[model samples]
Target: MDATTLNSQAERFLAELHRSPQTVRAYRADLRHLTDWLRETGHGLEREALEAYFTVHPHWASATRSRKQTTLERFCRWALQHHLLDRDPTLHLEHPRLPPPHPRGLRREDIERIFAVIPPEQTRDALLFRLVFETGLRIGEALGVHVEDLDLTRGDEHLTVLGKGSRKRTVLLDDPRLVSALRRYLRTLGYTHGPLFQATKNGRGGPLRYQSVQERWQGYAGRADMACTLHQLRHSHATELVNGGVSLATIRKRLGHQHIQTTLRYAEVSDSTADAELRRWRRQRH
Candidate 1:
C-alpha cells in the first residue's frame, strides 16, 4: 500500500501503542511527511522508495533525517506485523554515516544564570525545566510525563518515561532536590491524575503545548540576559555526567540515546577535566 493513503492504518499503528499524547502527535506529524513524499513520487513503501525519500533532502541535518527514518521504520515494522508487506523494507536499512552534531552542553554557572531569573511563582516551570536538566530528558519526553508515571516510593524514587520507539525506561529521581521539587509540585497540582505539567492558559487545564513551553523558556532566558534553548538543559546534564567520569554506557541509558557515539559527543570536556581524569587513571594503574 502507498504511504499516501496511510491515515487510517497510521492511526491504528499509533493507537495500538501505549504512547503519550505528545509522542502520538509527533509520530502523526512525521507520518504526514511520508504521506506527502509518496504523493509526490507515486511510490509504495518500498525500500528504494524510502531511501530516495530520505536522500531527497541531503541538505537536511542528520538529526532531522534520523527522526524521519525512525518514524518510517516503525511504520514499516507495524505494516509487516499486520501482513501489509511480504518483507520489512526497513529491516536492513542503514542510517547515513554522518557524525552527529557536537553536543553543546552548558556549564553550571551558565545554566544557573537562566534559573536565577525564573520567577518564584513559576513553580511548575521550575520543576519542569529542572527535571529535564537533571534527567537529560528530551523536552517532549518531560512534557509527556503524567502524574501516574512518577514513583516516589521511599528510597526507590524514579520516573517511568516513555522513550523513543515507544520504549519505556525507568528514570531514577536520583536528585534529592528533584524529588523534593516533584513532591512540592504534586501537592500544588490539586488533581490526582493527568499530565504532570498542564497548560494553565485562560484558567483551563489541558495538554501543555510544546510551543508554549519553548516560549516560556525563551522568556526566562531573556530575563537572565542569556541566549539559551530549552534543549541546552538536556545537553548540560549530559556534559555534567561526562565531566564527572560517568561511563558512556550508563550515560547512554540515562539519556535514552540510541547510540554510544551520540553519548560520546558529550565527552568533549575541558582540558583540565580531561587531564584530571587521566591523572586519576594513571595513579590507579600505578
Candidate 2:
C-alpha cells in the first residue's frame, strides 16, 4: 500500500526466493520504479493503480513492461498470502509474450583473428581470453576461479567454476591449445595459488573487476579490428560446441545453465550446417 511496505515485502520475497544478488538488485530496481509511479499518481497498491500506471506509460518497451509486471504480480501475491492485502491486485494480470532468443557468437575464423593479436608477452591477458572462450564461462565465474579449482594433474583435466546462484560445475580442459597455454602461464608465474586471475591495486590483490575485464577485452577487440565483447566469447564457445554435434545436455552442464531452454538458444544453425542439412535433405528426397 505504501513505498515502505512494498520495499520491506520485496526484500522478504527476494530472500525467500533465494535469488542471486544480481536478481535481487534487479527486483529492487523494478519495485522502486513502480513505487515511484504510485507516489506520483497518489495511488495505492491496487489493480486499478497498476492498470492506470500502465496506461500512463504506453511507450514503455515490452521487455521493460514485462519485468515490471512480473515484479508487481509477485509482490501482490506475497501481500495477499500474508494478509497485507484483502485481494491480489495482479490476479487478472497478463504476462507479456517474449520473443525467442537468438544468441550471436563468433565464427571459427573470427576467434582465430582475435587470438592472433595477443602476443606471447601478454600470456596473462591471453590466458584470460582463452579461458572464457574455451570454457564458455561467464565473466564472473571465470574471475571467481581459484588456483585450487584447476585440476591439471589428474586424468580428464578440468577446472571448477562457481556459476550463477552459487552453483559449481566442472569445465573440462580438453583443448590442447588451451591446455598448453595454461601450462605455460602457470610455469611463468612460478606459483600455483590464489585467484586464477589476480588484480593488484595499491599493492593489494583480489579478483579482477568486471569493468577491468571489459576494458581489456575491448582493447583486444580494437587491436584485432573485431567487434566483440567478453560475453560474446561465451556465445562463441557454445556455438562451436553446438555446431560440432555436441549434445544439448552436455552443453547445458558445461555452460552451467539451470534450464535446457537457455542452452537451446545456441542451437542456431551456422551457414555451413544449414547448407549441409539442405543438401542431405535433397539427396534423401531424390
Candidate 3:
C-alpha cells in the first residue's frame, strides 16, 4: 500500500471516528506514529509490520500498549470495511494485560505544596485545579462544567456536571474557600454563558481542550517540583472524604461514580487517618 494512500484512509477513519474530539486526536496521533515508523522501515501496513511495531516498543506499559492497540484495531477494521486492506491485521493481535487499579492520593501537605507554587496572579488555573481537588471531579467533568450549571445561591451552592456515561450529578460546593474563589473567578469572567473554563488562545471563550488542560496541569506540577497529576487531585478528594468518615454512598454520589465499586477503589485510608480513628474510638470507650 502506498504511504499517501494509507494516510488518506487513516484521515478518513479518524474523521468518521465521531467520538470525542480528544478521542479522535488520540487515534490520529497513534496512526501518525505508525505511519512514521512504516516510512522509516519501508514496510506496508500488514500483520507482520504491526507485530514488529509492538515488538520494538517493549518499554510501553500495558495500559499504553492497550490504548495504542485499540487505536490500530479501529483503524484497520475501518480500512478493511472500505476495501483498502485485504484483511484486519489487528483481529488476531493479542491484547495487553492491564494492571490492577491502584488509586493514588496525595497527602494534604503535598497538595498544599502544589497549590502554594501557583502564582497569585493565575487565579483561573488555581481555581480550576482546586475545584477538581475539593469536589472529586474527573478532569473532563470539571472541564465540561458550563457557567449556567452553577447554582451559587446563598444557602446552597452546587454545580451540575456531566460525568462518565453521560450521567449528570450535582456536586456540592461546601468548602468556603473554594466557593469564595469560584465567586471571584466568576466576577473576573463577566461571561454569563459558555464553558466555565475557557481557552485563552481563542479569546472567544471556547471550552478548553483536554490536552491543553493536562499540559497546563503538568507545568504547574513541574513548577511545584512535585509529580502530582490532574486525576490524582480527584483521588485526593475522595480519599480525604473517606478518611474523614464520609459514607461510601455519599462519596459515590459526589464523585458521580456510576457504581459503588468504583468509589471503593479509592477508599483506602492512610495510616495516620486509621490511627486517628482508633484514638477516637478509645476516647469514646471511656
Give TM-scores for every candidate, taking all chains together and pairing residue i with residue i.
0.65, 0.63, 0.64
Q: Which parts of model 3 are misplaced by more than 4 Å?
A: 1-96, 276-286
Candidate 1 lDDT over 131-222, as tens digits, reads: 99999999999999999999999899999899999988898889999899999889988898889999887999999999999999999999
Please give, for residues 1-286, the per-residue lDDT of candidate 3 as tens digits: 6566778788888878879989998888998888889888998888888899999999998998999999988888888888888888888889988767798999979988988988999898899999999998999888889999999996799999998889998889999999999998999887899899888885566778999889988988898899998989999999999989999999999998888988889998989988999999999999
Off by more than 4 A, model 1 = 1-100
Q: lDDT for model 2, please.
A: 0.83
Winning candidate number (lDDT): 3
Against the hidden true structure, what lDDT does model 1 obtain? 0.86
Model 3 lDDT vs. the true structure? 0.89
Q: Is candidate 1 or candidate 2 better by lDDT?
A: 1
Q: Model 1: which residue pairs collide? A: none
- The true-versus-predicted C-alpha distance at residue 110 of model 2, in Å, is 1.5
Clashes of each: 0, 0, 0
Q: lDDT of model 1 at residue 220?
A: 91
Is candidate 1 or 2 superior in TM-score? Answer: 1
